[model samples]
Target: MGRKRRLITDSFPKVKRRKGGPGPGKEDGAPEPGLRGEEPCEEILAAHLDETHLEILRQFDLNRHFGPCTGITRLQRWERAEQLGLEPPQEVLKVLWAHPEDPQYQCSLWHLYPI
Candidate 1:
Protein backbone atom coordinates (compact mmCIF):
# COMPACT_ATOMS: atom_id res chain seq x y z
CA MET A 1 0.00 0.00 0.00
CA GLY A 2 1.19 3.57 -0.75
CA ARG A 3 1.63 6.00 2.10
CA LYS A 4 -0.41 9.17 2.15
CA ARG A 5 1.44 12.45 2.25
CA ARG A 6 0.46 15.27 4.57
CA LEU A 7 0.04 18.84 3.37
CA ILE A 8 2.73 21.37 4.28
CA THR A 9 0.17 23.61 5.98
CA ASP A 10 -0.88 20.74 8.18
CA SER A 11 2.67 20.34 9.52
CA PHE A 12 3.54 24.02 9.94
CA PRO A 13 2.09 27.03 11.70
CA LYS A 14 0.88 29.84 9.44
CA VAL A 15 3.27 32.77 9.49
CA LYS A 16 1.59 36.05 10.29
CA ARG A 17 3.88 39.03 10.80
CA ARG A 18 7.34 38.84 9.27
CA LYS A 19 9.94 37.30 11.54
CA GLY A 20 11.78 40.57 12.21
CA GLY A 21 9.59 43.33 10.84
CA PRO A 22 5.95 44.23 11.41
CA GLY A 23 3.56 44.14 8.43
CA PRO A 24 -0.01 45.18 7.78
CA GLY A 25 -2.87 42.73 8.26
CA LYS A 26 -5.83 41.59 6.15
CA GLU A 27 -7.85 44.55 7.43
CA ASP A 28 -7.65 48.17 6.44
CA GLY A 29 -6.53 51.20 8.50
CA ALA A 30 -3.18 49.64 9.20
CA PRO A 31 -0.99 52.03 11.19
CA GLU A 32 1.53 54.03 9.19
CA PRO A 33 5.10 53.84 10.36
CA GLY A 34 6.21 56.97 12.30
CA LEU A 35 2.75 58.39 11.90
CA ARG A 36 0.89 56.78 14.79
CA GLY A 37 1.44 59.75 17.14
CA GLU A 38 2.03 62.51 14.63
CA GLU A 39 1.36 63.71 11.14
CA PRO A 40 4.18 63.83 8.59
CA CYS A 41 4.29 66.86 6.37
CA GLU A 42 5.23 66.99 2.70
CA GLU A 43 8.44 68.75 3.58
CA ILE A 44 9.54 65.88 5.86
CA LEU A 45 8.61 63.32 3.25
CA ALA A 46 10.30 65.34 0.53
CA ALA A 47 13.49 65.76 2.51
CA HIS A 48 14.28 62.08 2.57
CA LEU A 49 13.13 61.52 -0.98
CA ASP A 50 13.59 64.23 -3.55
CA GLU A 51 12.40 64.20 -7.14
CA THR A 52 15.09 61.70 -8.09
CA HIS A 53 14.40 59.46 -5.10
CA LEU A 54 10.71 59.78 -5.76
CA GLU A 55 11.32 58.40 -9.24
CA ILE A 56 13.14 55.48 -7.72
CA LEU A 57 10.19 54.96 -5.36
CA ARG A 58 7.73 55.01 -8.24
CA GLN A 59 9.68 52.32 -10.03
CA PHE A 60 10.16 50.32 -6.85
CA ASP A 61 6.48 50.39 -5.93
CA LEU A 62 5.63 48.95 -9.32
CA ASN A 63 7.50 45.73 -8.48
CA ARG A 64 6.54 44.62 -4.96
CA HIS A 65 5.07 41.40 -3.55
CA PHE A 66 2.46 41.54 -0.81
CA GLY A 67 1.42 39.16 2.00
CA PRO A 68 3.56 37.08 4.35
CA CYS A 69 7.21 35.86 3.96
CA THR A 70 8.45 39.18 2.61
CA GLY A 71 11.55 40.87 3.97
CA ILE A 72 12.94 44.41 3.85
CA THR A 73 16.55 45.20 4.78
CA ARG A 74 16.58 48.94 5.15
CA LEU A 75 17.32 49.73 8.76
CA GLN A 76 20.80 51.12 8.17
CA ARG A 77 19.83 53.59 5.49
CA TRP A 78 16.62 54.33 7.35
CA GLU A 79 18.55 55.32 10.49
CA ARG A 80 20.91 57.41 8.42
CA ALA A 81 18.01 59.18 6.81
CA GLU A 82 16.49 59.79 10.24
CA GLN A 83 19.71 60.99 11.86
CA LEU A 84 20.15 63.40 9.01
CA GLY A 85 16.64 64.54 9.94
CA LEU A 86 15.02 62.60 7.13
CA GLU A 87 12.37 59.91 7.00
CA PRO A 88 12.79 56.49 5.47
CA PRO A 89 11.74 56.29 1.85
CA GLN A 90 8.11 55.19 1.55
CA GLU A 91 7.12 51.52 1.27
CA VAL A 92 7.40 51.60 -2.53
CA LEU A 93 10.23 49.08 -2.48
CA LYS A 94 8.14 46.76 -0.35
CA VAL A 95 5.30 46.93 -2.85
CA LEU A 96 7.63 46.15 -5.73
CA TRP A 97 9.43 43.35 -3.93
CA ALA A 98 6.09 41.73 -3.23
CA HIS A 99 4.70 41.66 -6.78
CA PRO A 100 7.46 40.90 -9.24
CA GLU A 101 4.90 39.61 -11.70
CA ASP A 102 4.38 43.12 -13.10
CA PRO A 103 5.69 43.54 -16.66
CA GLN A 104 7.13 46.97 -15.94
CA TYR A 105 9.43 45.24 -13.48
CA GLN A 106 10.79 42.93 -16.16
CA CYS A 107 12.02 45.85 -18.22
CA SER A 108 13.80 47.21 -15.17
CA LEU A 109 15.22 43.87 -14.02
CA TRP A 110 18.58 44.28 -15.72
CA HIS A 111 19.48 47.39 -13.79
CA LEU A 112 17.60 46.62 -10.59
CA TYR A 113 18.17 42.89 -10.10
CA PRO A 114 21.37 41.85 -8.37
CA ILE A 115 23.84 39.61 -10.17
Candidate 2:
Protein backbone atom coordinates (compact mmCIF):
# COMPACT_ATOMS: atom_id res chain seq x y z
CA MET A 1 0.00 0.00 0.00
CA GLY A 2 1.19 3.56 -0.68
CA ARG A 3 2.13 5.77 2.28
CA LYS A 4 -0.69 8.07 3.41
CA ARG A 5 -0.11 11.77 2.78
CA ARG A 6 -0.05 14.17 5.72
CA LEU A 7 -2.09 17.35 5.85
CA ILE A 8 -0.92 20.62 7.34
CA THR A 9 -3.32 23.20 8.81
CA ASP A 10 -3.06 26.58 10.54
CA SER A 11 -2.81 26.66 14.36
CA PHE A 12 -6.03 27.10 16.38
CA PRO A 13 -6.93 30.68 17.23
CA LYS A 14 -6.13 31.96 20.71
CA VAL A 15 -8.94 32.27 23.23
CA LYS A 16 -9.04 35.47 25.21
CA ARG A 17 -11.04 35.95 28.38
CA ARG A 18 -13.08 39.08 28.77
CA LYS A 19 -11.78 41.95 30.89
CA GLY A 20 -14.59 41.42 33.39
CA GLY A 21 -14.16 38.87 36.16
CA PRO A 22 -16.78 36.33 35.04
CA GLY A 23 -20.27 35.92 33.62
CA PRO A 24 -21.63 37.43 30.48
CA GLY A 25 -22.20 41.21 30.22
CA LYS A 26 -21.34 41.64 33.92
CA GLU A 27 -18.89 43.74 35.90
CA ASP A 28 -18.36 44.15 39.63
CA GLY A 29 -21.80 45.05 41.04
CA ALA A 30 -22.79 46.76 37.82
CA PRO A 31 -25.74 46.08 35.54
CA GLU A 32 -24.91 44.10 32.41
CA PRO A 33 -23.35 46.23 29.72
CA GLY A 34 -25.98 45.25 27.18
CA LEU A 35 -28.78 46.23 29.55
CA ARG A 36 -27.70 49.83 29.52
CA GLY A 37 -30.32 52.32 28.25
CA GLU A 38 -33.06 49.74 28.73
CA GLU A 39 -36.19 50.54 30.67
CA PRO A 40 -36.86 49.03 34.07
CA CYS A 41 -38.88 45.81 34.32
CA GLU A 42 -41.90 47.52 35.80
CA GLU A 43 -42.27 49.82 32.86
CA ILE A 44 -41.82 47.07 30.33
CA LEU A 45 -44.28 44.74 32.02
CA ALA A 46 -46.81 47.46 32.65
CA ALA A 47 -46.71 48.58 29.08
CA HIS A 48 -46.73 45.22 27.35
CA LEU A 49 -48.15 42.62 29.74
CA ASP A 50 -51.89 42.08 29.89
CA GLU A 51 -53.79 42.20 33.17
CA THR A 52 -54.16 38.40 33.52
CA HIS A 53 -50.49 37.63 33.20
CA LEU A 54 -49.62 40.67 35.26
CA GLU A 55 -51.90 39.41 37.99
CA ILE A 56 -50.33 35.96 37.83
CA LEU A 57 -46.88 37.47 38.09
CA ARG A 58 -48.08 39.46 41.07
CA GLN A 59 -49.45 36.33 42.75
CA PHE A 60 -45.94 34.95 42.81
CA ASP A 61 -44.52 38.30 43.88
CA LEU A 62 -42.34 37.96 40.81
CA ASN A 63 -42.34 41.68 40.16
CA ARG A 64 -41.11 42.40 43.67
CA HIS A 65 -38.25 39.92 43.40
CA PHE A 66 -37.66 39.91 39.68
CA GLY A 67 -38.24 43.53 38.76
CA PRO A 68 -36.33 45.19 35.95
CA CYS A 69 -33.29 45.69 38.11
CA THR A 70 -33.37 42.00 38.96
CA GLY A 71 -35.72 39.09 38.59
CA ILE A 72 -36.30 36.23 36.20
CA THR A 73 -35.75 36.63 32.51
CA ARG A 74 -38.61 35.38 30.38
CA LEU A 75 -36.66 32.30 29.37
CA GLN A 76 -35.64 31.57 32.93
CA ARG A 77 -39.24 31.78 34.01
CA TRP A 78 -40.17 28.92 31.70
CA GLU A 79 -37.28 26.85 32.93
CA ARG A 80 -38.19 27.54 36.53
CA ALA A 81 -41.81 26.64 35.96
CA GLU A 82 -40.77 23.29 34.59
CA GLN A 83 -38.37 22.66 37.43
CA LEU A 84 -40.98 23.45 40.04
CA GLY A 85 -43.60 21.36 38.26
CA LEU A 86 -45.54 24.53 37.63
CA GLU A 87 -47.60 25.08 34.56
CA PRO A 88 -47.40 28.79 33.98
CA PRO A 89 -50.32 30.41 32.24
CA GLN A 90 -50.21 30.54 28.45
CA GLU A 91 -50.51 34.30 28.57
CA VAL A 92 -47.44 34.51 30.82
CA LEU A 93 -45.51 32.42 28.34
CA LYS A 94 -46.42 34.80 25.55
CA VAL A 95 -44.41 37.63 27.05
CA LEU A 96 -41.34 38.15 24.90
CA TRP A 97 -38.87 40.88 24.16
CA ALA A 98 -36.03 41.68 21.84
CA HIS A 99 -33.43 41.61 24.59
CA PRO A 100 -32.30 39.04 27.16
CA GLU A 101 -31.53 41.79 29.68
CA ASP A 102 -34.45 41.10 31.97
CA PRO A 103 -34.07 40.14 35.60
CA GLN A 104 -33.10 36.55 36.34
CA TYR A 105 -34.57 34.61 39.21
CA GLN A 106 -32.13 32.36 40.90
CA CYS A 107 -33.41 28.80 41.38
CA SER A 108 -32.62 29.25 45.05
CA LEU A 109 -35.54 31.64 45.35
CA TRP A 110 -37.91 28.81 44.56
CA HIS A 111 -36.47 26.81 47.45
CA LEU A 112 -38.17 29.17 49.85
CA TYR A 113 -41.51 27.80 48.87
CA PRO A 114 -42.95 24.38 49.87
CA ILE A 115 -43.20 22.72 46.50
Candidate 3:
Protein backbone atom coordinates (compact mmCIF):
# COMPACT_ATOMS: atom_id res chain seq x y z
CA MET A 1 0.00 0.00 0.00
CA GLY A 2 1.24 3.54 -0.82
CA ARG A 3 1.44 6.31 1.78
CA LYS A 4 -1.45 8.77 1.85
CA ARG A 5 -0.66 12.18 0.30
CA ARG A 6 -1.85 15.47 1.89
CA LEU A 7 -2.89 18.51 -0.15
CA ILE A 8 -1.89 22.02 1.03
CA THR A 9 -3.82 24.98 -0.35
CA ASP A 10 -3.39 28.70 0.30
CA SER A 11 -7.11 29.50 -0.04
CA PHE A 12 -8.48 31.11 3.08
CA PRO A 13 -12.01 32.15 4.06
CA LYS A 14 -13.00 35.63 2.91
CA VAL A 15 -13.32 38.26 5.60
CA LYS A 16 -16.91 39.22 6.02
CA ARG A 17 -17.65 42.90 5.79
CA ARG A 18 -19.29 44.46 8.80
CA LYS A 19 -22.55 46.24 8.12
CA GLY A 20 -21.60 49.82 8.86
CA GLY A 21 -21.73 53.33 7.46
CA PRO A 22 -24.76 55.22 6.06
CA GLY A 23 -26.31 53.14 3.31
CA PRO A 24 -28.94 54.08 0.73
CA GLY A 25 -31.90 52.69 2.68
CA LYS A 26 -31.12 55.09 5.52
CA GLU A 27 -29.08 57.84 3.90
CA ASP A 28 -30.44 61.33 4.24
CA GLY A 29 -31.85 61.97 0.84
CA ALA A 30 -34.65 64.46 0.30
CA PRO A 31 -37.35 64.02 2.90
CA GLU A 32 -39.86 61.85 1.14
CA PRO A 33 -43.10 61.75 3.05
CA GLY A 34 -44.57 59.28 0.61
CA LEU A 35 -45.22 62.07 -1.87
CA ARG A 36 -43.43 63.98 -4.61
CA GLY A 37 -42.23 67.53 -3.97
CA GLU A 38 -44.70 67.79 -1.11
CA GLU A 39 -43.61 68.63 2.38
CA PRO A 40 -44.11 65.93 4.94
CA CYS A 41 -46.88 66.82 7.34
CA GLU A 42 -46.79 66.37 11.09
CA GLU A 43 -48.56 63.03 10.81
CA ILE A 44 -46.11 61.65 8.29
CA LEU A 45 -43.19 62.97 10.25
CA ALA A 46 -44.52 61.31 13.38
CA ALA A 47 -44.75 58.00 11.56
CA HIS A 48 -41.22 58.35 10.30
CA LEU A 49 -39.97 59.32 13.73
CA ASP A 50 -41.75 56.48 15.46
CA GLU A 51 -40.10 54.10 13.07
CA THR A 52 -36.64 55.59 13.63
CA HIS A 53 -36.46 57.56 16.88
CA LEU A 54 -38.01 55.06 19.26
CA GLU A 55 -34.68 53.64 20.40
CA ILE A 56 -32.77 56.91 20.39
CA LEU A 57 -35.51 58.66 22.32
CA ARG A 58 -35.15 56.06 25.03
CA GLN A 59 -31.51 56.92 25.49
CA PHE A 60 -31.93 60.72 25.26
CA ASP A 61 -35.29 61.05 26.93
CA LEU A 62 -33.98 62.05 30.36
CA ASN A 63 -35.92 63.40 33.31
CA ARG A 64 -37.67 60.10 33.48
CA HIS A 65 -39.06 60.90 36.91
CA PHE A 66 -40.59 64.05 35.47
CA GLY A 67 -42.11 61.83 32.83
CA PRO A 68 -40.68 61.17 29.34
CA CYS A 69 -38.72 64.35 28.80
CA THR A 70 -36.28 64.50 25.93
CA GLY A 71 -32.84 64.37 27.48
CA ILE A 72 -31.24 65.92 24.43
CA THR A 73 -32.22 69.06 22.57
CA ARG A 74 -34.04 69.23 19.23
CA LEU A 75 -30.86 70.01 17.39
CA GLN A 76 -29.29 66.91 18.89
CA ARG A 77 -32.17 64.83 17.64
CA TRP A 78 -31.85 66.17 14.12
CA GLU A 79 -28.13 65.60 14.10
CA ARG A 80 -28.52 62.10 15.44
CA ALA A 81 -31.09 61.28 12.78
CA GLU A 82 -28.81 62.58 10.10
CA GLN A 83 -25.92 60.58 11.49
CA LEU A 84 -28.05 57.48 11.51
CA GLY A 85 -28.62 57.98 7.79
CA LEU A 86 -32.12 59.35 8.05
CA GLU A 87 -33.29 62.55 6.47
CA PRO A 88 -35.10 64.74 8.93
CA PRO A 89 -38.15 66.33 7.40
CA GLN A 90 -37.51 69.83 6.13
CA GLU A 91 -40.51 71.22 7.97
CA VAL A 92 -39.37 69.49 11.13
CA LEU A 93 -35.96 71.07 10.81
CA LYS A 94 -37.54 74.44 10.12
CA VAL A 95 -39.78 74.14 13.15
CA LEU A 96 -36.85 73.21 15.36
CA TRP A 97 -34.67 75.96 13.97
CA ALA A 98 -37.47 78.47 14.56
CA HIS A 99 -37.63 77.53 18.23
CA PRO A 100 -34.47 75.86 19.40
CA GLU A 101 -35.31 76.27 23.04
CA ASP A 102 -39.03 75.73 22.79
CA PRO A 103 -40.21 72.36 21.52
CA GLN A 104 -42.80 71.98 18.81
CA TYR A 105 -45.50 69.31 18.53
CA GLN A 106 -44.97 68.94 14.80
CA CYS A 107 -41.46 67.63 15.39
CA SER A 108 -42.64 65.08 17.96
CA LEU A 109 -41.30 67.36 20.65
CA TRP A 110 -44.28 66.54 22.83
CA HIS A 111 -43.31 62.89 22.91
CA LEU A 112 -39.92 63.58 24.47
CA TYR A 113 -40.71 66.69 26.45
CA PRO A 114 -43.69 68.63 27.70
CA ILE A 115 -44.41 71.27 25.06
Candidate 4:
Protein backbone atom coordinates (compact mmCIF):
# COMPACT_ATOMS: atom_id res chain seq x y z
CA MET A 1 0.00 0.00 0.00
CA GLY A 2 2.97 2.37 -0.43
CA ARG A 3 2.73 2.78 -4.23
CA LYS A 4 2.60 6.40 -5.45
CA ARG A 5 -0.78 7.48 -6.80
CA ARG A 6 -1.26 8.88 -10.35
CA LEU A 7 -3.34 12.09 -10.45
CA ILE A 8 -6.82 11.66 -12.07
CA THR A 9 -6.12 14.42 -14.62
CA ASP A 10 -2.89 12.71 -15.68
CA SER A 11 -4.64 9.37 -16.10
CA PHE A 12 -7.06 10.65 -18.78
CA PRO A 13 -6.60 12.36 -22.13
CA LYS A 14 -7.58 16.06 -22.29
CA VAL A 15 -10.29 17.24 -24.74
CA LYS A 16 -10.62 20.93 -25.64
CA ARG A 17 -14.21 22.06 -25.15
CA ARG A 18 -15.55 23.92 -28.16
CA LYS A 19 -16.75 27.40 -27.25
CA GLY A 20 -19.81 27.44 -29.55
CA GLY A 21 -21.16 24.01 -28.69
CA PRO A 22 -20.26 20.32 -28.28
CA GLY A 23 -20.34 19.42 -31.98
CA PRO A 24 -22.07 20.08 -35.30
CA GLY A 25 -24.05 16.86 -34.75
CA LYS A 26 -26.61 17.43 -31.97
CA GLU A 27 -26.07 21.20 -31.70
CA ASP A 28 -27.82 21.55 -35.04
CA GLY A 29 -30.98 20.20 -33.33
CA ALA A 30 -31.85 16.51 -33.12
CA PRO A 31 -32.91 14.29 -30.27
CA GLU A 32 -30.34 12.08 -28.58
CA PRO A 33 -30.32 8.83 -30.59
CA GLY A 34 -31.97 5.82 -28.86
CA LEU A 35 -33.41 8.12 -26.18
CA ARG A 36 -36.51 8.88 -28.24
CA GLY A 37 -37.85 8.73 -31.76
CA GLU A 38 -37.32 11.51 -34.27
CA GLU A 39 -40.44 13.60 -33.89
CA PRO A 40 -42.94 13.14 -36.71
CA CYS A 41 -43.29 16.12 -39.03
CA GLU A 42 -46.36 17.84 -37.68
CA GLU A 43 -46.64 20.16 -40.70
CA ILE A 44 -46.85 17.23 -43.06
CA LEU A 45 -48.98 15.18 -40.73
CA ALA A 46 -51.37 18.10 -40.28
CA ALA A 47 -52.27 18.14 -43.95
CA HIS A 48 -53.56 14.56 -43.74
CA LEU A 49 -53.95 13.77 -40.05
CA ASP A 50 -56.65 15.08 -37.74
CA GLU A 51 -56.38 15.54 -33.99
CA THR A 52 -57.47 11.96 -33.41
CA HIS A 53 -54.90 10.51 -35.80
CA LEU A 54 -52.14 12.69 -34.36
CA GLU A 55 -52.97 11.58 -30.83
CA ILE A 56 -52.92 7.95 -31.90
CA LEU A 57 -49.42 8.28 -33.30
CA ARG A 58 -48.24 10.22 -30.23
CA GLN A 59 -49.52 7.47 -27.93
CA PHE A 60 -47.86 4.81 -30.04
CA ASP A 61 -44.61 6.75 -30.01
CA LEU A 62 -44.70 6.90 -26.22
CA ASN A 63 -45.71 3.24 -25.96
CA ARG A 64 -43.88 1.07 -28.47
CA HIS A 65 -43.19 -2.67 -28.68
CA PHE A 66 -39.57 -3.09 -29.73
CA GLY A 67 -37.83 0.24 -29.20
CA PRO A 68 -38.16 4.00 -29.45
CA CYS A 69 -40.03 4.89 -32.65
CA THR A 70 -36.73 6.32 -33.89
CA GLY A 71 -35.36 3.89 -36.46
CA ILE A 72 -38.63 2.61 -37.89
CA THR A 73 -41.09 4.26 -40.24
CA ARG A 74 -44.54 5.26 -38.99
CA LEU A 75 -46.08 2.60 -41.18
CA GLN A 76 -43.95 -0.08 -39.57
CA ARG A 77 -44.94 1.12 -36.10
CA TRP A 78 -48.62 0.97 -37.01
CA GLU A 79 -48.24 -2.60 -38.20
CA ARG A 80 -46.43 -3.65 -35.03
CA ALA A 81 -49.11 -2.02 -32.92
CA GLU A 82 -51.78 -3.91 -34.81
CA GLN A 83 -49.95 -7.16 -34.21
CA LEU A 84 -49.96 -6.35 -30.50
CA GLY A 85 -53.70 -5.59 -30.60
CA LEU A 86 -53.21 -1.83 -30.23
CA GLU A 87 -55.34 -0.06 -32.81
CA PRO A 88 -53.27 2.88 -33.93
CA PRO A 89 -54.98 5.14 -36.44
CA GLN A 90 -55.13 3.80 -39.99
CA GLU A 91 -54.38 7.28 -41.39
CA VAL A 92 -50.77 6.88 -40.31
CA LEU A 93 -50.32 4.00 -42.75
CA LYS A 94 -52.21 5.83 -45.46
CA VAL A 95 -50.17 9.02 -45.01
CA LEU A 96 -46.93 7.09 -45.17
CA TRP A 97 -48.01 5.38 -48.38
CA ALA A 98 -49.36 8.55 -49.97
CA HIS A 99 -46.14 10.45 -49.40
CA PRO A 100 -43.40 9.80 -51.93
CA GLU A 101 -40.67 8.02 -50.00
CA ASP A 102 -39.60 10.70 -47.55
CA PRO A 103 -36.13 10.18 -46.08
CA GLN A 104 -37.79 10.62 -42.71
CA TYR A 105 -40.24 7.77 -43.28
CA GLN A 106 -37.54 5.31 -44.36
CA CYS A 107 -35.61 3.50 -41.61
CA SER A 108 -35.11 0.38 -39.50
CA LEU A 109 -35.31 -0.09 -35.73
CA TRP A 110 -31.93 -1.82 -35.88
CA HIS A 111 -33.24 -4.71 -37.98
CA LEU A 112 -34.21 -5.40 -41.57
CA TYR A 113 -37.40 -7.33 -40.89
CA PRO A 114 -37.03 -10.71 -42.54
CA ILE A 115 -39.46 -11.68 -45.28
Highest-scoring model, lDDT: 4
2 versus 3: better lDDT goes to: 3
- Give TM per candidate: 0.23, 0.26, 0.30, 0.35
Cα misplacement distance, residue 11 of candidate 1 (Å) = 1.7
Greater-TM-score candidate between 1 and 2: 2
lDDT of 3 by residue, 5-94 (tens): 655643565555448654556655655456755754787787786555443433333423323334555566666766766665555455
**Which candidate's TM-score is highest?**
4
Give the per-residue lDDT of model 4 (tens digit) for 1-115: 9998889899799878779675744665566753446555665467465555445545555665534566567677777777888777666676567554754333433335553
For candidate 3, give the lDDT.
0.51
Better of 2 and 4 by TM-score: 4
lDDT of 2: 0.49
Tell me the lDDT of model 1 at 33. 64
For model 3, the run of ten residues with the poorest summed lDDT: 60-69
Q: Over 4 Å off in model 4, which ranges?
A: 1-67, 106-115
Task: Tally clashes: model 4.
Answer: 0
lDDT of each: 0.46, 0.49, 0.51, 0.60
lDDT of 2 at 93: 50
For model 1, residues 1-115, the per-residue Cα lDDT tens digits are 5988889789888766656564555345556567644656776676564545445644443443321111332333333444766444556445445445654432332334554
